[model samples]
Target: MKKTLTGIFSGLAILIFILSIGLMISGTIALRRNEPVFVFGRAVAVVPTDSMVGNEPDSLDVNDMVIIRKATIDEVEIGDVIVFQGVNGSGNPILVIHRVVDIQDEGIITKGDNNSSIDQPSYQDYVSNDNFQGIFQTKITFLKPLSQMMSSSKSLIFGGLAIVLTIMLISEVIHLVRTYQDEKNEAIKKKHEEEIEALKEKQKQEIIEEILRDNQK
Candidate 1:
């Protein structure tokens, strides 16, 4: 039972670790390609700028990780922070996250909580539901730094994971060998005891036969 539970937990840990690595790889690809990294219904992004930071409630800081979920036009109410694909000043597409301060006839107007003015009057100023990736669901304040470190030292992380898995595999093999040997030894002992009991029974029958022959003589 203990071994069974150990196997279960080990399997779960390995599965979780594999999933984390996959996410890291996918996130790296998405960031480089300027695409949204989606897991289930949510998108994950690492904050590269401090535009969202300031004296406001739930402000996001640089290097923070955020989870975003799909939002409908109706669901995008005032005060809701939204993520969208937009062109930056250099005319390159980028992901932007900001709060909705006003709903307009054409679309919604957004501004960074820390910025003094609304978004520059470009294609990015007015956002529609079609441009939306999602609304901010939650944030992981400390994960971005760790993720950056892991991404920078991928070789070291891979080596560590390999070593740990090798050790676990070796331990499992040793346990299996010891269990097999113990069972074999127990079987041999049982057989030896059975043989000795049979010998004693044969000797008792022989002695009784000898006593009967002497009485007849």
Candidate 2:
């Protein structure tokens, strides 16, 4: 039972390590290209603003980590929260997360929950299928704290990866040593048993010889 539990935990650790590496690589690429990185049709984002904050349960807060799934324009409906690429006041491209208020023949109109009015058409324009990123699925409640920590200390992530690798290395070394010790002990036991068997055979032969001598006399 202990070994089984160890195996399960080790498997989880390895899986987490692999996921971390993939995220690191993908994040680096996204940074270079200035775009969100999606893995397996899903993307994670840390909320930068409280525009979606409200009294509702689904309202988003700053620093919250959310999971978004790739979706088409047809897959979204009114009131569905979505992430899309838009331009800021300075014409610089930015990502916006808002709830769809209305769907028009031309494009989709979105408004933030805390905002008084919909996004300005001149600034953001109507969201079309071309700039649609994904639909918000849910907030990552468990990893929200971790996300904040990582954002504050970028080195923490690499430090965690290092620790995981060290642990795995130590586990492998210990396993090898134990395996070698077990094999060595088994070999010693086999040799000792063979020696005892040989000694018993010699004594039996001597007894037989003694019996033969007595019979001859």
All candidates: TM-score: 0.55, 0.58
Candidate 1, residues 1-217: lDDT per residue as tens digits?
9998799669757865675677667756766676566655566556667789977666788767677786676788889888877877798988898888888887888888787787735547578767777899888766665545544564643443333334444455557668987999999999999999999999999999999999999
In order, candidate lDDTs are 0.72, 0.75
Q: Which pairs of residues collide in candidate 2?
A: none
lDDT of 2 by residue, 103-173 (tens): 88779999889988898475587888788889998886676676666556647643433343344444565
- lDDT of prediction 2: 0.75
Query: Where in model 1 is the C-alpha error above 4 Å?
Result: 1-33, 123-125, 147-217
Worst 10 residues of 1 by lDDT: 157-166
Q: In model 2, how many backbone clashes occur?
A: 0
Cα deviation of 174 in candidate 2 (Å)?
A: 24
